[model samples]
Target: MIKIAVVGCGQIAQRWLRVLTAHPKVSVTALVDTDLAAARRLHALGQVDAVTATTVHQALALANVEAIVNLTPPAAEPEMTRLGLTLGLHVLAEKPLTVRAAPAQALIAHAEQVGRRLMVMRNRAFDPGYSAFVRSVAGRGPLLAAGETFVQLRAPGFRTAHTALADLGVHAIEQARRLTDAPVIAVRCTEHPAAHLAPHAGLVTLLLEFADETVVSWRGGYAGPGLRTPANGRWSADTATGSATFDGQRQLRVGDEMVELEPAAPGYELCIGDMLAVLTGGSITPASVSATDHATSISVLEAATLSLSTGDRIQLAGTR
Candidate 1:
Protein backbone atom coordinates (compact mmCIF):
# COMPACT_ATOMS: atom_id res chain seq x y z
CA MET A 1 0.00 0.00 0.00
CA ILE A 2 1.21 3.53 -0.78
CA LYS A 3 1.85 5.59 2.33
CA ILE A 4 0.61 9.18 2.06
CA ALA A 5 1.10 12.07 4.46
CA VAL A 6 -1.25 15.03 4.51
CA VAL A 7 0.30 18.38 5.40
CA GLY A 8 -1.91 21.18 6.63
CA CYS A 9 -4.96 20.74 8.86
CA GLY A 10 -7.24 23.26 7.26
CA GLN A 11 -10.72 22.48 5.96
CA ILE A 12 -9.39 21.33 2.61
CA ALA A 13 -7.04 19.05 4.48
CA GLN A 14 -9.92 17.56 6.39
CA ARG A 15 -11.70 16.83 3.13
CA TRP A 16 -8.57 15.15 1.81
CA LEU A 17 -7.99 13.11 4.96
CA ARG A 18 -11.56 11.93 5.04
CA VAL A 19 -11.36 10.65 1.51
CA LEU A 20 -7.87 9.25 1.87
CA THR A 21 -8.81 7.26 4.96
CA ALA A 22 -11.76 5.73 3.13
CA HIS A 23 -9.65 4.51 0.20
CA PRO A 24 -8.76 0.84 0.78
CA LYS A 25 -5.67 0.81 -1.43
CA VAL A 26 -3.99 3.78 0.29
CA SER A 27 -2.83 4.25 3.90
CA VAL A 28 -2.88 7.57 5.73
CA THR A 29 0.53 7.54 7.31
CA ALA A 30 0.79 10.94 8.93
CA LEU A 31 -1.15 14.14 9.61
CA VAL A 32 1.15 17.17 9.79
CA ASP A 33 -0.04 20.62 10.73
CA THR A 34 1.27 23.64 12.55
CA ASP A 35 -1.30 23.08 15.26
CA LEU A 36 -0.63 19.71 16.82
CA ALA A 37 -3.92 19.76 18.70
CA ALA A 38 -5.97 20.41 15.58
CA ALA A 39 -4.14 17.72 13.67
CA ARG A 40 -4.66 15.21 16.43
CA ARG A 41 -8.34 16.08 16.68
CA LEU A 42 -8.87 15.54 12.99
CA HIS A 43 -6.89 12.31 12.97
CA ALA A 44 -8.97 11.01 15.84
CA LEU A 45 -12.13 11.67 13.84
CA GLY A 46 -10.69 9.95 10.78
CA GLN A 47 -9.13 6.98 12.69
CA VAL A 48 -5.63 7.74 11.40
CA ASP A 49 -2.84 6.27 13.55
CA ALA A 50 0.13 8.52 12.90
CA VAL A 51 -0.13 12.28 13.52
CA THR A 52 2.38 15.12 13.44
CA ALA A 53 1.11 18.51 14.48
CA THR A 54 4.41 20.22 13.87
CA THR A 55 6.39 21.92 11.16
CA VAL A 56 6.79 20.12 7.82
CA HIS A 57 10.49 19.65 8.56
CA GLN A 58 9.73 17.68 11.69
CA ALA A 59 6.97 15.67 10.06
CA LEU A 60 9.01 14.88 6.99
CA ALA A 61 11.81 13.50 9.12
CA LEU A 62 9.53 11.51 11.39
CA ALA A 63 7.09 9.87 8.99
CA ASN A 64 7.91 7.02 6.64
CA VAL A 65 6.00 8.83 3.97
CA GLU A 66 6.15 8.21 0.22
CA ALA A 67 4.08 11.20 -0.90
CA ILE A 68 3.09 14.49 0.70
CA VAL A 69 -0.26 16.04 -0.15
CA ASN A 70 0.30 19.78 0.43
CA LEU A 71 -2.77 21.75 1.50
CA THR A 72 -1.28 24.99 2.68
CA PRO A 73 -2.13 28.57 1.62
CA PRO A 74 -0.56 30.30 -1.38
CA ALA A 75 2.19 31.96 0.68
CA ALA A 76 3.54 28.75 2.19
CA GLU A 77 3.03 26.58 -0.91
CA PRO A 78 6.31 27.34 -2.69
CA GLU A 79 8.51 26.78 0.35
CA MET A 80 6.82 23.55 1.36
CA THR A 81 6.92 22.18 -2.16
CA ARG A 82 10.59 23.10 -2.52
CA LEU A 83 11.47 21.26 0.68
CA GLY A 84 9.42 18.23 -0.27
CA LEU A 85 11.00 18.03 -3.74
CA THR A 86 14.46 18.40 -2.22
CA LEU A 87 13.73 15.46 0.05
CA GLY A 88 12.85 13.28 -2.96
CA LEU A 89 9.26 12.87 -1.83
CA HIS A 90 6.55 12.84 -4.46
CA VAL A 91 4.41 15.95 -3.95
CA LEU A 92 0.78 16.61 -4.81
CA ALA A 93 0.49 20.33 -4.12
CA GLU A 94 -2.57 22.49 -4.05
CA LYS A 95 -3.06 24.61 -7.17
CA PRO A 96 -1.81 28.04 -8.15
CA LEU A 97 1.40 26.09 -7.63
CA THR A 98 2.91 29.39 -6.66
CA VAL A 99 1.76 33.00 -6.52
CA ARG A 100 4.08 33.87 -9.43
CA ALA A 101 4.84 31.96 -12.60
CA ALA A 102 8.65 32.06 -12.69
CA PRO A 103 9.14 30.33 -9.34
CA ALA A 104 6.50 27.79 -10.26
CA GLN A 105 8.36 27.01 -13.49
CA ALA A 106 11.63 26.59 -11.61
CA LEU A 107 9.99 24.19 -9.15
CA ILE A 108 8.46 22.13 -11.94
CA ALA A 109 11.86 22.02 -13.65
CA HIS A 110 13.53 20.79 -10.48
CA ALA A 111 10.85 18.18 -9.96
CA GLU A 112 11.40 16.94 -13.51
CA GLN A 113 15.17 16.78 -13.06
CA VAL A 114 14.91 14.84 -9.81
CA GLY A 115 12.61 12.23 -11.38
CA ARG A 116 10.08 12.83 -8.60
CA ARG A 117 6.37 13.19 -9.24
CA LEU A 118 5.17 16.77 -8.71
CA MET A 119 1.43 16.91 -9.26
CA VAL A 120 -0.74 19.95 -8.74
CA MET A 121 -4.24 19.67 -7.32
CA ARG A 122 -6.14 20.95 -10.29
CA ASN A 123 -9.06 18.84 -9.15
CA ARG A 124 -11.73 20.54 -11.25
CA ALA A 125 -10.55 18.53 -14.25
CA PHE A 126 -11.43 15.31 -12.50
CA ASP A 127 -14.67 16.63 -11.08
CA PRO A 128 -17.29 14.23 -12.39
CA GLY A 129 -19.70 17.10 -13.04
CA TYR A 130 -17.07 19.12 -14.89
CA SER A 131 -15.83 16.08 -16.82
CA ALA A 132 -19.32 15.39 -18.03
CA PHE A 133 -19.45 18.94 -19.29
CA VAL A 134 -16.14 18.53 -21.10
CA ARG A 135 -17.26 15.34 -22.83
CA SER A 136 -20.60 16.84 -23.80
CA VAL A 137 -19.04 19.90 -25.40
CA ALA A 138 -15.82 18.47 -26.84
CA GLY A 139 -17.76 16.44 -29.43
CA ARG A 140 -18.82 19.70 -31.09
CA GLY A 141 -15.22 20.22 -32.24
CA PRO A 142 -13.49 23.62 -32.37
CA LEU A 143 -15.74 25.49 -29.98
CA LEU A 144 -17.32 28.76 -31.10
CA ALA A 145 -18.64 30.31 -27.90
CA ALA A 146 -17.65 29.47 -24.34
CA GLY A 147 -17.72 31.38 -21.02
CA GLU A 148 -16.74 30.30 -17.51
CA THR A 149 -17.37 32.19 -14.26
CA PHE A 150 -15.92 31.34 -10.81
CA VAL A 151 -16.98 33.86 -8.21
CA GLN A 152 -16.73 33.52 -4.44
CA LEU A 153 -19.57 35.43 -2.83
CA ARG A 154 -18.52 34.45 0.64
CA ALA A 155 -14.98 34.30 1.85
CA PRO A 156 -13.80 30.73 2.30
CA GLY A 157 -10.63 31.76 4.07
CA PHE A 158 -7.59 33.45 2.47
CA ARG A 159 -8.55 36.66 0.64
CA THR A 160 -5.77 38.07 -1.46
CA ALA A 161 -5.26 39.51 -4.95
CA HIS A 162 -3.84 36.15 -6.00
CA THR A 163 -6.68 34.18 -4.47
CA ALA A 164 -9.36 35.67 -6.69
CA LEU A 165 -7.75 34.50 -9.90
CA ALA A 166 -5.17 31.95 -8.95
CA ASP A 167 -7.27 29.98 -6.49
CA LEU A 168 -10.62 30.25 -8.29
CA GLY A 169 -10.05 31.22 -11.91
CA VAL A 170 -7.29 28.64 -12.30
CA HIS A 171 -10.06 26.15 -12.79
CA ALA A 172 -12.05 28.40 -15.15
CA ILE A 173 -9.06 29.39 -17.26
CA GLU A 174 -7.97 25.77 -17.44
CA GLN A 175 -11.46 24.62 -18.29
CA ALA A 176 -11.61 27.25 -21.02
CA ARG A 177 -8.30 26.11 -22.44
CA ARG A 178 -9.43 22.50 -22.33
CA LEU A 179 -12.89 23.15 -23.73
CA THR A 180 -11.49 25.30 -26.51
CA ASP A 181 -8.32 24.24 -28.27
CA ALA A 182 -7.27 27.87 -28.67
CA PRO A 183 -5.01 29.55 -26.18
CA VAL A 184 -5.95 32.81 -24.50
CA ILE A 185 -4.43 35.34 -26.85
CA ALA A 186 -5.67 38.49 -25.09
CA VAL A 187 -7.26 39.53 -21.79
CA ARG A 188 -8.82 42.55 -20.00
CA CYS A 189 -9.84 43.04 -16.36
CA THR A 190 -11.22 45.78 -14.11
CA GLU A 191 -10.83 46.39 -10.40
CA HIS A 192 -12.28 48.72 -7.81
CA PRO A 193 -10.35 51.43 -5.96
CA ALA A 194 -8.35 50.85 -2.79
CA ALA A 195 -11.39 51.90 -0.81
CA HIS A 196 -13.12 48.87 -2.28
CA LEU A 197 -10.16 46.52 -2.57
CA ALA A 198 -8.66 48.77 -5.31
CA PRO A 199 -8.38 46.10 -7.96
CA HIS A 200 -9.57 43.23 -5.82
CA ALA A 201 -13.15 42.98 -7.00
CA GLY A 202 -12.86 42.98 -10.77
CA LEU A 203 -13.66 41.07 -13.92
CA VAL A 204 -11.29 39.34 -16.32
CA THR A 205 -12.39 38.61 -19.86
CA LEU A 206 -10.20 36.67 -22.23
CA LEU A 207 -10.39 36.61 -26.02
CA LEU A 208 -9.15 33.44 -27.69
CA GLU A 209 -8.87 32.80 -31.42
CA PHE A 210 -8.09 29.38 -32.84
CA ALA A 211 -6.48 28.10 -36.05
CA ASP A 212 -9.84 26.66 -37.12
CA GLU A 213 -11.45 30.12 -37.03
CA THR A 214 -13.08 29.17 -33.74
CA VAL A 215 -13.47 31.91 -31.13
CA VAL A 216 -13.89 31.55 -27.35
CA SER A 217 -14.62 34.22 -24.78
CA TRP A 218 -14.12 33.50 -21.08
CA ARG A 219 -15.05 35.82 -18.22
CA GLY A 220 -14.32 35.25 -14.52
CA GLY A 221 -14.52 37.36 -11.39
CA TYR A 222 -15.20 37.34 -7.63
CA ALA A 223 -17.10 40.58 -7.37
CA GLY A 224 -20.80 41.23 -6.95
CA PRO A 225 -23.55 38.72 -6.14
CA GLY A 226 -22.76 36.13 -8.79
CA LEU A 227 -24.79 33.23 -10.21
CA ARG A 228 -28.39 32.51 -9.27
CA THR A 229 -27.80 28.83 -8.63
CA PRO A 230 -27.39 28.74 -4.85
CA ALA A 231 -24.04 27.06 -4.24
CA ASN A 232 -24.70 26.01 -7.82
CA GLY A 233 -21.73 25.90 -10.20
CA ARG A 234 -22.38 24.48 -13.64
CA TRP A 235 -20.46 24.40 -16.91
CA SER A 236 -22.92 24.68 -19.81
CA ALA A 237 -21.60 23.75 -23.23
CA ASP A 238 -23.62 24.91 -26.18
CA THR A 239 -23.76 22.92 -29.41
CA ALA A 240 -26.02 22.97 -32.48
CA THR A 241 -27.97 19.93 -31.34
CA GLY A 242 -28.58 21.57 -27.97
CA SER A 243 -26.80 22.65 -24.78
CA ALA A 244 -25.66 20.44 -21.93
CA THR A 245 -25.44 21.71 -18.36
CA PHE A 246 -23.25 19.76 -16.00
CA ASP A 247 -24.50 20.58 -12.53
CA GLY A 248 -22.12 20.78 -9.60
CA GLN A 249 -23.61 17.60 -8.15
CA ARG A 250 -22.61 15.35 -11.07
CA GLN A 251 -25.84 15.52 -13.02
CA LEU A 252 -25.78 15.98 -16.80
CA ARG A 253 -28.37 17.27 -19.18
CA VAL A 254 -27.88 16.76 -22.93
CA GLY A 255 -30.75 17.04 -25.37
CA ASP A 256 -33.82 15.66 -23.61
CA GLU A 257 -31.92 13.30 -21.33
CA MET A 258 -31.06 14.36 -17.81
CA VAL A 259 -28.89 11.69 -16.30
CA GLU A 260 -27.96 11.56 -12.64
CA LEU A 261 -24.52 10.17 -12.10
CA GLU A 262 -23.36 8.45 -8.94
CA PRO A 263 -22.14 10.94 -6.35
CA ALA A 264 -19.03 11.96 -8.23
CA ALA A 265 -15.74 11.22 -6.55
CA PRO A 266 -14.24 13.80 -4.20
CA GLY A 267 -11.40 15.92 -5.61
CA TYR A 268 -8.72 15.10 -3.01
CA GLU A 269 -9.29 11.35 -3.18
CA LEU A 270 -9.09 11.44 -6.93
CA CYS A 271 -5.82 13.32 -6.74
CA ILE A 272 -4.28 10.93 -4.21
CA GLY A 273 -5.67 7.94 -6.08
CA ASP A 274 -4.06 9.12 -9.30
CA MET A 275 -0.75 9.65 -7.54
CA LEU A 276 -0.81 6.18 -5.95
CA ALA A 277 -1.83 4.60 -9.24
CA VAL A 278 1.30 6.02 -10.84
CA LEU A 279 3.60 4.75 -8.07
CA THR A 280 2.34 1.20 -8.48
CA GLY A 281 3.72 1.00 -12.02
CA GLY A 282 1.03 3.08 -13.70
CA SER A 283 1.75 5.93 -16.10
CA ILE A 284 0.85 9.53 -15.29
CA THR A 285 -1.55 11.21 -17.68
CA PRO A 286 -1.43 14.73 -19.12
CA ALA A 287 -4.88 15.54 -17.83
CA SER A 288 -3.42 16.53 -14.41
CA VAL A 289 -0.60 18.77 -15.66
CA SER A 290 -2.24 20.32 -18.72
CA ALA A 291 -3.68 23.17 -16.61
CA THR A 292 -1.42 22.84 -13.57
CA ASP A 293 0.67 25.87 -14.54
CA HIS A 294 -0.71 28.86 -12.68
CA ALA A 295 1.62 31.27 -14.49
CA THR A 296 -0.74 31.82 -17.39
CA SER A 297 -3.55 32.17 -14.91
CA ILE A 298 -1.47 34.68 -12.95
CA SER A 299 -0.49 36.56 -16.12
CA VAL A 300 -4.09 36.87 -17.20
CA LEU A 301 -4.85 38.13 -13.69
CA GLU A 302 -2.03 40.62 -14.05
CA ALA A 303 -3.61 41.90 -17.23
CA ALA A 304 -6.86 42.27 -15.38
CA THR A 305 -5.01 44.22 -12.72
CA LEU A 306 -3.67 46.58 -15.35
CA SER A 307 -7.06 47.04 -16.96
CA LEU A 308 -8.48 47.91 -13.58
CA SER A 309 -5.69 50.41 -12.92
CA THR A 310 -5.81 52.18 -16.30
CA GLY A 311 -9.51 51.67 -17.04
CA ASP A 312 -8.44 50.40 -20.47
CA ARG A 313 -8.01 47.00 -22.04
CA ILE A 314 -4.65 45.44 -21.23
CA GLN A 315 -3.54 43.28 -24.10
CA LEU A 316 -1.28 40.32 -23.45
CA ALA A 317 2.24 40.50 -24.91
CA GLY A 318 2.21 37.15 -26.73
CA THR A 319 -1.44 37.10 -27.83
CA ARG A 320 -0.44 38.79 -31.10
Candidate 2:
Protein backbone atom coordinates (compact mmCIF):
# COMPACT_ATOMS: atom_id res chain seq x y z
CA MET A 1 0.00 0.00 0.00
CA ILE A 2 1.18 3.56 -0.68
CA LYS A 3 1.31 5.29 2.66
CA ILE A 4 0.15 8.89 2.34
CA ALA A 5 -0.13 11.93 4.58
CA VAL A 6 -3.15 14.22 4.18
CA VAL A 7 -2.29 17.82 4.95
CA GLY A 8 -5.17 20.19 5.63
CA CYS A 9 -8.50 19.13 7.00
CA GLY A 10 -10.86 21.51 5.24
CA GLN A 11 -13.92 20.60 3.19
CA ILE A 12 -11.80 19.62 0.20
CA ALA A 13 -9.64 17.52 2.49
CA GLN A 14 -12.71 15.70 3.74
CA ARG A 15 -13.68 14.80 0.19
CA TRP A 16 -10.18 13.57 -0.62
CA LEU A 17 -10.08 11.58 2.60
CA ARG A 18 -13.22 9.73 1.61
CA VAL A 19 -11.47 8.61 -1.57
CA LEU A 20 -8.12 7.88 0.11
CA THR A 21 -9.52 5.91 3.01
CA ALA A 22 -11.71 3.80 0.75
CA HIS A 23 -9.00 2.94 -1.76
CA PRO A 24 -7.57 -0.57 -1.43
CA LYS A 25 -4.03 0.35 -2.49
CA VAL A 26 -3.79 3.47 -0.32
CA SER A 27 -3.40 4.02 3.39
CA VAL A 28 -3.83 7.36 5.10
CA THR A 29 -1.05 7.43 7.68
CA ALA A 30 -1.31 10.94 9.00
CA LEU A 31 -3.51 14.03 8.97
CA VAL A 32 -1.98 17.51 9.32
CA ASP A 33 -3.73 20.77 9.99
CA THR A 34 -3.05 23.97 11.88
CA ASP A 35 -6.18 23.20 13.79
CA LEU A 36 -5.27 19.95 15.47
CA ALA A 37 -8.86 19.28 16.42
CA ALA A 38 -9.93 19.50 12.79
CA ALA A 39 -7.36 16.90 11.85
CA ARG A 40 -8.51 14.69 14.73
CA ARG A 41 -12.10 15.08 13.62
CA LEU A 42 -11.36 13.99 10.06
CA HIS A 43 -9.17 11.17 11.35
CA ALA A 44 -12.08 9.90 13.38
CA LEU A 45 -14.70 10.50 10.72
CA GLY A 46 -12.58 8.75 8.12
CA GLN A 47 -11.85 5.98 10.60
CA VAL A 48 -8.39 5.63 9.08
CA ASP A 49 -6.58 5.11 12.37
CA ALA A 50 -4.08 7.76 11.39
CA VAL A 51 -2.06 10.05 13.60
CA THR A 52 -2.93 13.74 13.65
CA ALA A 53 -0.42 16.56 13.67
CA THR A 54 -0.59 20.34 13.62
CA THR A 55 2.41 20.64 11.36
CA VAL A 56 4.00 18.77 8.47
CA HIS A 57 7.16 18.19 10.50
CA GLN A 58 5.24 16.57 13.28
CA ALA A 59 3.31 14.46 10.78
CA LEU A 60 6.48 13.31 9.07
CA ALA A 61 8.06 12.47 12.42
CA LEU A 62 5.00 10.46 13.38
CA ALA A 63 4.46 8.49 10.16
CA ASN A 64 6.32 6.78 7.34
CA VAL A 65 4.59 8.69 4.58
CA GLU A 66 5.63 8.18 0.97
CA ALA A 67 3.30 10.75 -0.58
CA ILE A 68 1.45 13.90 0.44
CA VAL A 69 -2.12 14.86 -0.44
CA ASN A 70 -2.06 18.63 -0.03
CA LEU A 71 -5.50 20.14 0.49
CA THR A 72 -4.12 23.28 1.99
CA PRO A 73 -5.39 26.69 0.88
CA PRO A 74 -3.85 28.22 -2.24
CA ALA A 75 -1.39 30.36 -0.25
CA ALA A 76 -0.05 27.40 1.68
CA GLU A 77 0.01 24.94 -1.25
CA PRO A 78 3.38 25.97 -2.62
CA GLU A 79 5.23 25.64 0.68
CA MET A 80 3.52 22.37 1.56
CA THR A 81 4.23 20.89 -1.86
CA ARG A 82 7.80 22.14 -1.92
CA LEU A 83 8.47 20.65 1.49
CA GLY A 84 6.97 17.32 0.45
CA LEU A 85 9.05 17.16 -2.73
CA THR A 86 12.17 18.16 -0.84
CA LEU A 87 11.49 15.35 1.60
CA GLY A 88 11.40 12.87 -1.33
CA LEU A 89 7.64 12.47 -1.44
CA HIS A 90 5.21 12.74 -4.30
CA VAL A 91 2.53 15.42 -3.93
CA LEU A 92 -1.04 15.73 -5.17
CA ALA A 93 -2.45 19.18 -4.51
CA GLU A 94 -5.68 21.04 -4.91
CA LYS A 95 -5.92 23.64 -7.67
CA PRO A 96 -4.74 27.08 -8.68
CA LEU A 97 -1.44 25.31 -7.91
CA THR A 98 -0.29 28.43 -6.20
CA VAL A 99 -1.91 31.89 -6.87
CA ARG A 100 0.59 32.75 -9.60
CA ALA A 101 2.56 31.14 -12.41
CA ALA A 102 6.14 31.87 -11.38
CA PRO A 103 6.05 30.00 -8.08
CA ALA A 104 4.11 27.18 -9.72
CA GLN A 105 6.84 26.88 -12.34
CA ALA A 106 9.44 26.84 -9.58
CA LEU A 107 7.64 24.00 -7.82
CA ILE A 108 7.50 22.07 -11.09
CA ALA A 109 11.24 22.51 -11.52
CA HIS A 110 11.89 21.39 -7.94
CA ALA A 111 9.77 18.27 -8.41
CA GLU A 112 11.74 17.42 -11.53
CA GLN A 113 15.06 17.85 -9.73
CA VAL A 114 13.87 15.53 -6.97
CA GLY A 115 12.52 12.97 -9.48
CA ARG A 116 9.14 13.03 -7.71
CA ARG A 117 5.69 13.39 -9.22
CA LEU A 118 3.73 16.58 -8.59
CA MET A 119 0.12 16.77 -9.76
CA VAL A 120 -2.70 19.21 -9.15
CA MET A 121 -6.33 18.23 -8.90
CA ARG A 122 -8.07 19.28 -12.11
CA ASN A 123 -10.94 17.07 -11.06
CA ARG A 124 -13.23 18.40 -13.78
CA ALA A 125 -11.05 16.66 -16.35
CA PHE A 126 -11.97 13.35 -14.82
CA ASP A 127 -15.69 13.97 -14.82
CA PRO A 128 -17.40 11.56 -17.22
CA GLY A 129 -19.55 14.28 -18.75
CA TYR A 130 -16.69 16.64 -19.36
CA SER A 131 -14.57 13.78 -20.66
CA ALA A 132 -17.28 12.87 -23.13
CA PHE A 133 -17.51 16.47 -24.31
CA VAL A 134 -13.77 16.63 -24.85
CA ARG A 135 -13.88 13.44 -26.86
CA SER A 136 -16.77 14.68 -28.94
CA VAL A 137 -14.95 17.87 -29.82
CA ALA A 138 -11.68 16.11 -30.60
CA GLY A 139 -10.29 16.83 -34.07
CA ARG A 140 -12.98 19.44 -34.63
CA GLY A 141 -10.88 22.65 -34.79
CA PRO A 142 -12.69 24.79 -32.25
CA LEU A 143 -13.14 28.49 -33.07
CA LEU A 144 -15.23 29.97 -30.30
CA ALA A 145 -15.99 28.76 -26.80
CA ALA A 146 -18.08 30.04 -23.91
CA GLY A 147 -18.60 29.03 -20.29
CA GLU A 148 -21.07 30.35 -17.72
CA THR A 149 -21.42 29.85 -14.00
CA PHE A 150 -23.79 31.35 -11.45
CA VAL A 151 -24.03 30.33 -7.86
CA GLN A 152 -24.97 31.84 -4.53
CA LEU A 153 -21.99 31.73 -2.21
CA ARG A 154 -21.37 33.00 1.28
CA ALA A 155 -18.46 35.36 0.73
CA PRO A 156 -15.44 34.60 2.89
CA GLY A 157 -13.28 37.47 4.04
CA PHE A 158 -10.35 36.17 2.05
CA ARG A 159 -12.30 35.98 -1.25
CA THR A 160 -11.65 39.25 -3.03
CA ALA A 161 -12.70 40.47 -6.47
CA HIS A 162 -9.34 39.53 -7.95
CA THR A 163 -8.93 36.29 -6.05
CA ALA A 164 -12.38 35.06 -7.00
CA LEU A 165 -11.26 34.40 -10.57
CA ALA A 166 -8.69 31.86 -9.50
CA ASP A 167 -10.85 30.64 -6.64
CA LEU A 168 -13.87 29.79 -8.81
CA GLY A 169 -13.22 30.47 -12.47
CA VAL A 170 -10.02 28.48 -12.93
CA HIS A 171 -12.04 25.37 -13.61
CA ALA A 172 -13.76 27.00 -16.57
CA ILE A 173 -10.46 28.38 -17.80
CA GLU A 174 -8.93 24.91 -17.63
CA GLN A 175 -11.90 23.48 -19.45
CA ALA A 176 -11.58 26.06 -22.22
CA ARG A 177 -7.92 25.21 -22.62
CA ARG A 178 -8.79 21.53 -22.87
CA LEU A 179 -11.53 22.12 -25.40
CA THR A 180 -9.34 24.25 -27.62
CA ASP A 181 -6.19 22.21 -26.95
CA ALA A 182 -4.30 25.46 -27.21
CA PRO A 183 -2.29 27.80 -25.04
CA VAL A 184 -3.87 31.04 -23.88
CA ILE A 185 -1.87 33.83 -25.41
CA ALA A 186 -3.77 36.78 -24.04
CA VAL A 187 -6.65 37.66 -21.74
CA ARG A 188 -9.00 40.59 -21.01
CA CYS A 189 -11.18 40.63 -17.96
CA THR A 190 -13.93 42.81 -16.42
CA GLU A 191 -15.63 42.70 -13.03
CA HIS A 192 -19.04 44.14 -12.16
CA PRO A 193 -20.32 44.90 -8.70
CA ALA A 194 -22.70 42.43 -7.14
CA ALA A 195 -25.04 43.95 -4.59
CA HIS A 196 -25.78 40.59 -3.00
CA LEU A 197 -22.12 39.84 -2.23
CA ALA A 198 -19.38 41.53 -0.25
CA PRO A 199 -17.97 44.70 -1.77
CA HIS A 200 -14.87 42.84 -2.87
CA ALA A 201 -16.82 40.09 -4.59
CA GLY A 202 -18.25 40.71 -8.05
CA LEU A 203 -19.35 39.01 -11.25
CA VAL A 204 -16.30 38.32 -13.42
CA THR A 205 -16.04 37.92 -17.16
CA LEU A 206 -12.97 37.06 -19.21
CA LEU A 207 -12.01 36.87 -22.84
CA LEU A 208 -9.15 34.45 -23.46
CA GLU A 209 -7.45 34.29 -26.85
CA PHE A 210 -5.49 31.13 -27.48
CA ALA A 211 -2.42 30.54 -29.60
CA ASP A 212 -4.48 28.77 -32.24
CA GLU A 213 -6.61 31.92 -32.61
CA THR A 214 -9.52 30.33 -30.80
CA VAL A 215 -11.28 32.57 -28.31
CA VAL A 216 -13.22 31.70 -25.17
CA SER A 217 -15.63 33.98 -23.32
CA TRP A 218 -16.15 33.05 -19.70
CA ARG A 219 -18.45 34.57 -17.08
CA GLY A 220 -19.12 33.56 -13.49
CA GLY A 221 -19.97 34.95 -10.09
CA TYR A 222 -21.29 34.08 -6.62
CA ALA A 223 -24.35 36.28 -6.95
CA GLY A 224 -26.98 33.98 -8.34
CA PRO A 225 -29.78 35.11 -6.09
CA GLY A 226 -32.56 32.84 -7.39
CA LEU A 227 -30.97 30.79 -10.18
CA ARG A 228 -27.96 28.64 -9.47
CA THR A 229 -25.79 26.84 -11.97
CA PRO A 230 -24.24 23.44 -11.56
CA ALA A 231 -20.84 23.41 -9.93
CA ASN A 232 -19.23 22.47 -13.26
CA GLY A 233 -21.08 25.29 -15.02
CA ARG A 234 -22.30 25.19 -18.64
CA TRP A 235 -19.79 24.90 -21.50
CA SER A 236 -20.12 25.20 -25.27
CA ALA A 237 -17.76 25.39 -28.19
CA ASP A 238 -18.08 26.08 -31.89
CA THR A 239 -15.86 24.10 -34.20
CA ALA A 240 -15.22 23.88 -37.92
CA THR A 241 -17.43 20.83 -38.11
CA GLY A 242 -20.26 21.77 -35.75
CA SER A 243 -21.10 22.94 -32.24
CA ALA A 244 -20.99 21.04 -28.98
CA THR A 245 -22.49 21.88 -25.62
CA PHE A 246 -22.26 20.36 -22.17
CA ASP A 247 -25.07 21.36 -19.82
CA GLY A 248 -23.09 20.51 -16.65
CA GLN A 249 -25.67 17.84 -15.96
CA ARG A 250 -23.82 14.99 -17.64
CA GLN A 251 -25.61 15.83 -20.87
CA LEU A 252 -23.74 16.66 -24.04
CA ARG A 253 -25.27 17.90 -27.28
CA VAL A 254 -23.13 17.61 -30.35
CA GLY A 255 -24.80 19.12 -33.37
CA ASP A 256 -28.01 17.18 -33.91
CA GLU A 257 -26.94 14.18 -31.86
CA MET A 258 -26.98 13.88 -28.10
CA VAL A 259 -23.83 12.15 -26.97
CA GLU A 260 -24.50 9.43 -24.45
CA LEU A 261 -22.55 9.67 -21.18
CA GLU A 262 -22.08 6.87 -18.72
CA PRO A 263 -22.58 7.67 -15.11
CA ALA A 264 -19.32 7.60 -13.17
CA ALA A 265 -18.05 8.15 -9.66
CA PRO A 266 -17.49 11.65 -8.34
CA GLY A 267 -14.52 13.62 -9.70
CA TYR A 268 -12.54 13.19 -6.48
CA GLU A 269 -12.84 9.42 -6.61
CA LEU A 270 -11.79 9.26 -10.24
CA CYS A 271 -8.88 11.65 -9.73
CA ILE A 272 -7.56 9.69 -6.76
CA GLY A 273 -7.91 6.46 -8.72
CA ASP A 274 -5.81 7.89 -11.53
CA MET A 275 -3.24 9.17 -9.06
CA LEU A 276 -2.95 5.72 -7.55
CA ALA A 277 -2.51 4.28 -11.00
CA VAL A 278 0.32 6.72 -11.71
CA LEU A 279 2.01 5.86 -8.40
CA THR A 280 1.85 2.20 -9.39
CA GLY A 281 3.88 2.84 -12.55
CA GLY A 282 1.07 3.59 -14.98
CA SER A 283 1.88 6.21 -17.59
CA ILE A 284 0.45 9.69 -17.14
CA THR A 285 -1.68 10.82 -20.06
CA PRO A 286 -1.65 14.28 -21.59
CA ALA A 287 -5.04 14.83 -20.00
CA SER A 288 -3.59 14.26 -16.55
CA VAL A 289 -3.16 17.56 -14.66
CA SER A 290 0.58 17.49 -14.02
CA ALA A 291 2.14 20.41 -12.24
CA THR A 292 3.68 21.53 -15.53
CA ASP A 293 0.34 21.61 -17.35
CA HIS A 294 -1.43 23.31 -14.46
CA ALA A 295 1.22 26.01 -14.38
CA THR A 296 -0.15 27.30 -17.67
CA SER A 297 -3.61 27.44 -16.15
CA ILE A 298 -2.17 29.44 -13.29
CA SER A 299 -0.57 31.77 -15.80
CA VAL A 300 -3.91 32.34 -17.51
CA LEU A 301 -5.55 33.11 -14.19
CA GLU A 302 -2.75 35.43 -13.17
CA ALA A 303 -2.99 37.27 -16.46
CA ALA A 304 -6.74 37.57 -16.06
CA THR A 305 -6.28 39.07 -12.61
CA LEU A 306 -3.79 41.56 -14.00
CA SER A 307 -6.21 42.45 -16.76
CA LEU A 308 -8.97 42.92 -14.24
CA SER A 309 -6.81 45.38 -12.33
CA THR A 310 -5.13 47.25 -15.20
CA GLY A 311 -8.07 47.29 -17.62
CA ASP A 312 -5.72 46.18 -20.37
CA ARG A 313 -5.50 42.98 -22.37
CA ILE A 314 -2.63 41.03 -20.80
CA GLN A 315 -0.39 39.12 -23.17
CA LEU A 316 1.49 36.02 -22.07
CA ALA A 317 4.95 34.94 -23.13
CA GLY A 318 5.90 31.49 -24.50
CA THR A 319 2.54 31.02 -26.14
CA ARG A 320 4.09 30.01 -29.44
Best by lDDT: 2
For residue 146, give model 1's deviation from the true position in Å.
4.1
Residue runs of model 2 more than 4 Å from their true location after superposition: 155-161, 193-195, 198-201, 318-320
User: What TM-score does candidate 2 reach?
Assistant: 0.92
In candidate 1, what are the lDDT values of residues 138-217, reduced to their tens digit? 75766555555646444546565534555555566556655655455555544322225334554555555544454556
Report per-prediction Cα RMSD to one decimal. Answer: 3.9, 2.1
Give the TM-score of each candidate: 0.80, 0.92
- Model 2 accuracy (lDDT, Cα): 0.81
Question: Candidate 2: RMSD over Cα atoms?
Answer: 2.1
lDDT over C-alpha atoms for residue 165 of model 2: 81
The CA lDDT at 139 in model 2 is 76
Q: Residue 126, candidate 2: how far off, in angstroms?
A: 3.7
